[model samples]
Target: MSWSDSFLVLVLALAVEAAFGYPGRLYTRIGHPVTWIGRLIKALDRSFNRETWSAGRRRAAGLLALLVLLAVTGLAARSMEFALAATGPIGFCAIAVLASSLLAQRSLHEHVAAVSTGLREHGIEGGRAAVSMIVGRNPQSLDEAGVSRAAIESLAENFSDGIVAPAFWLGIGGPTGAVLYKAANTADSMIGHRTPRHEAFGWAAARFDDLVNLPASRLTALLIVIAAALNRNASPRAALRALFRDARHHRSPNAGWPEAAMAGALGLRLAGPRIYGNVRVEDRWMGDGRADATAQDIDRALVLYRTACTLLFGLALTIPMLIWLIAS
Candidate 1:
């Protein structure tokens, strides 16, 4: 298929996902792509990662394991594409449906919004329960405001990692590119950590995930800023300012950009010191706004998020048409 066709597929995929997220019945029956990738990563970790091995050896083994996972994932995606190419329009639709599974637009929104609902209806305990589903932080450590901030933080970071990153790769290399990214990202989430067990073995997955996420993170931040401009409740100037001023301070190289933009746009402070498990991590606050975020703030963040997603769809639709026009 042509490059334009591939981009069109991406646009269609995004629309499809936004309209109807992965069916609960379908997931119960076959599980999801990320789960499948997670299983592979788990096996590799068990087989290759050993306490007896030196850090250097474990690192090499981790890199090899990652290569194997990507190779397997890429081959399968390419084979599917090649087979689907023969069926014309039906195949295009099928490819789009499959590709849509890789994105988390609907799921991310639902999960984050649930936190707000929980906070409103059930209070602090309810908010903690809901936010725990999305974030890895210790739920008990959070009060109502912390719960709200955690939900917003998860929404901003996942906006870049879950939605934009996959779509960006899909536009670039079709299903194969997106699938490979999902695999790498899944690996990083499963194994990439600074803990004693994974610090050495997960180094490759961690680094590679960071490398792939670099472009999408920046793009997501810009998208958030533009979305803020369109949102009356949000401040575009502040969003842009926070993007420049505070994004660099967050621990993760890629996560800070979108988080800072979202924080500034909504006039809320985020990140700062937080507990993950028993560990209290000390980090710089993202925005210079109020740290006492409420459920209302989460609603505002959702508005900005939905608008940014719309902007992404517009770009996806426009860019391909522009390329075709230039070629013609």
Candidate 2:
């Protein structure tokens, strides 16, 4: 396909995902790209992560394992890129479908909506269960407010990681960029824990994920700040302040940006100390807003999130056309 045609496909893929998401029938049968990448990451983790190895050796093994992962996934994605170019219109459509599956726009909305609905209908127990599926914290330990806060935090963070990051890469380099990102992200999720088993072996995946996600995560925050400018009880200035102050204090270099931005945008506190399983993490909170968050706050956050996504879509559509015009 031509450059303009390729960009059009990239934009279409984003639109398709934002509108329809991945099809359930396809998910039930062949599964999704993230799932496929997850399986490979799991296999590599199983094979390379041996407790018998020394920490230094395990770290090196981790680096080696990551390279192998990149090589395998990169080849598959590049082959797809070539095949798409060779097959004309059908392949273009096929690649757009494949790229759409790599994004999480539709599923994110559904998942966050489920959490809010569970809270409204099933009370604390339901909210906790729904929130637990998305967050790392111990669900049973959370109160109604905590559950709501957790759900909102997950929405903001994953909005950046799962949605914006993939789309940014896809827009830049199409399917190969999108697939490579998914592989790195999957590896990070699978092995990026600080536990004894993964602390050394998962180092590369964690760091690489951080590096690749750096730009998108910040852009996600900026988008949220812009969205906050258009809403009430939400301050764009506060969002910017929180993003600069609290974003640096969070555990993950990337996650804190959007999470802090969303927190400030919604006027709610997030990411404070929480219990994950038996462990209590003394993490700093994001935002200088309300401490007692509610389901209503979640609704507000979702509004801001949806608006940010729309603005992002507009920018994605416009920037390329501008470039095309300039070049011509």
The candidate scoring highest on TM-score is 1
lDDT of 2 at 140: 87
| Model 1 steric clash pairs | none
What is candidate 1's lDDT per residue for 1-328, written digit by digit as tens? 6678879989999999999999999999999999999998999999999989999999999999999999999999999998997898899899999999999999999999999999999999999999999999999999999999999999999999999999999999889999999999999999999989999999999999999999999999999999999989999999888889999999999999999999999999999999999999999999999999999999999999999999999999998999899999
TM agreement with the true structure for every prediction: 0.99, 0.97
Residue-wise C-alpha lDDT for candidate 2, range 206-325, written one tens digit per residue: 999999999999899999999999888689999998999999999989999999999888888999999999899999999998878888888888888889888888877887798799
The global Cα lDDT (0 to 1) of model 2 is 0.88
lDDT of each: 0.96, 0.88
Top candidate on lDDT is 1
